[model samples]
Target: MCIPPEAQWKRATIPDRRSVPFFGQGRGLTDSQSLDSIPPPPSPKLRRAQKVAEQKAQRIQDFKQRCGPGFSSSSAWQARPWQHRIAIEQGIRKQDALPEEMEVVEDPTIEEPVGINPVQVEVGEFEEPTVDVEEIVAENPCQNYHCKHGKVCELDENNTPMCVCQDPSSCPASTAVFEKVCGTDNKTYDTSCHFFATKCTLEGTKKGHKLHLDYIGPCKFIPECLDTELSEFPLRMRDWLKNVLVTLYERDEDNNLLTEKQKLRVKKIHENEKRLEAGDHTVELLTRDFEKNYNMYIFPVHWQFGQLDQHPVDGYLSHTELAPLRAPLIPMEHCTTRFFETCDLDNDKYIALEEWGNCFGIKEKDIDKDLVI
Candidate 1:
């Protein structure tokens, strides 16, 4: 069933991984196995988890002993044990300079109870409410089960949450032109949702495997890239990357377009008043500017690689990972495939950071691992 984003995001508890018991040969002990014969947890991962849980329980017990039996810590306190940290964060911590009104949850009073979770706080008193496990489960049966882009979670005949392919018609109509995307099939989709939902229907097919979101906008005719033009593709791309950074710097807005580290790096480029402005300069002009301001292009090359090398993040980008950069450029630059294929150099079907850096004309020495940020 299709659900609105606001409704789908409703907060409710669902079953967690901890509740499920691991069952496998030589993993979990059999019920018939005698207590003495039982092995030290076969799974090192499970043993680590148990050790961590035991340490937490011991710490909580030690804390209760230190604070006295009457002192009952809230659930949040039991979870994090950070009454002073919470108080300091919420600006209610009592210091020698501050008054009693600025008291931390560690020093609670009957007159003014201050702690985490307002639901647990009953006006002037704090009490943990009796929870109805069934009721919470009913409200959020699908909470733990997240579906992919074109699917939604719904209870099946057995009342178990399962992700189903969403109907393309259920997708909301695009309000702007840019929302319409072109797929690798050279057909324009109403929106990304329409494309993904349609693609989901064709799952496990030869067509589906080849299909991908080609670009951000509708399909348009792009002239074939010749051998000579293909050679100059990198020149134009490097220039574009540098100019994109400069444009973003000039329009300095902290809408999370770039991280603080990225901002600091771009700030240096922005300070250089001699940097090229945003425009459709000729390839010859672009090449000349790249030679004149070579340093400005290096980080942008690394930055683009970092942006795409995120799925598994092993310092290597697979074909799927490169899709975001490649798919968009394919419709505009016909040399997109040839250029990337050339970058692989070894034809390993994966592009490393070094390969990506070299493709952009960055010197072998300048392509440092430290610049990947």
Candidate 2:
């Protein structure tokens, strides 16, 4: 039969101990665990716990010194004996050796967390659209000149102050010609023209371009043609073209004192002026020489070199004094080739009239058949 439930539990429990001494108690089973030999339970004071906490703190610091971003520089790991002693005594991390990579434990004095949550944004304030005001156009006050009742005074081309009239006949003081031409003779003209009395009629086409000549003669049209000749036409145009080219290609003396073309032209002019001054020949023969060879072909060449060197338009250099120059342009042996090259007649050594025609836009066939190279 099963023992009663309480009686079985009582068997598992030691019988009431009336006879054993206080230490010799529980189990004759273990001598070491006898009641008198049983050791006291650990004290509530936690001396081991304190030691364990200190070890754990030491381990944490060692871990930081070895693995933190600034690990090598940490005082705990620093090779300096004094630093090591300080680390051991203080048990506090050095601020200078604090790991850059570590998320520092927040300290109110040294490492406070910033409040950086995004601010709540409120939306839906509507702004009124601004309207731009336009400038006002004032009315033209049309004042009446004839009857003193006009609505607005009219403005003239020059925007001068003037009265407007409804009737032309009533205002004699307000004399105005809608279309007018004024005439004044220039006192600077060498001689007065009796034909157009007050003003000399400038001999020009309706389009205002002056006429040119085929040849100079004791022609009545010479004065009207601005004293230009068929012979001088090419000379004048060449000089003008040379001047323009010189003007455009001109550089300051600092950049380039004189260009090759300019040097050639200056030399040629200098040579010609020297020839003219010797006066070994009659003026008539020289005049004839100028006229004969002028328009033929060499006129352009001679004219190219035969003008005064005016000051450069950009004003880099002051006007140079032009004296009667006496330089032999190019040695005689190379002069012929140099002349052709200077003219760019062939853009090569050969001097061909066809090439000259091509360069100057003149007809090749029109070049004088008798002209010599």
In terms of TM-score, the best-performing candidate is 1
Q: lDDT per prediction?
A: 0.70, 0.33
Residue-level lDDT of model 1, residues 116-200, one tens digit each, is 6344445646466877676443466898897877888899889999999999999999999888998879999999999989998
Q: Model 1 has how many clashing residue pairs?
A: 0
* CA shift of 79, model 1, Å: 99
Point out where model 1 deviates above 4 Å. 1-141, 156-161, 174-177, 253-255, 327-331, 346-349
State in Å the error of residue 304, model 2: 8.8
Candidate 1, residue 191: lDDT: 94
lDDT of 2 by residue, 140-160 (tens): 543333222221255678754
Candidate 2 positional error at 348, Å: 42
User: Which segments of candidate 2 are over 4 A away from where they belong?
Assistant: 1-184, 188-282, 285-297, 301-373
Model 1 whole-model lDDT (C-alpha atoms):
0.70
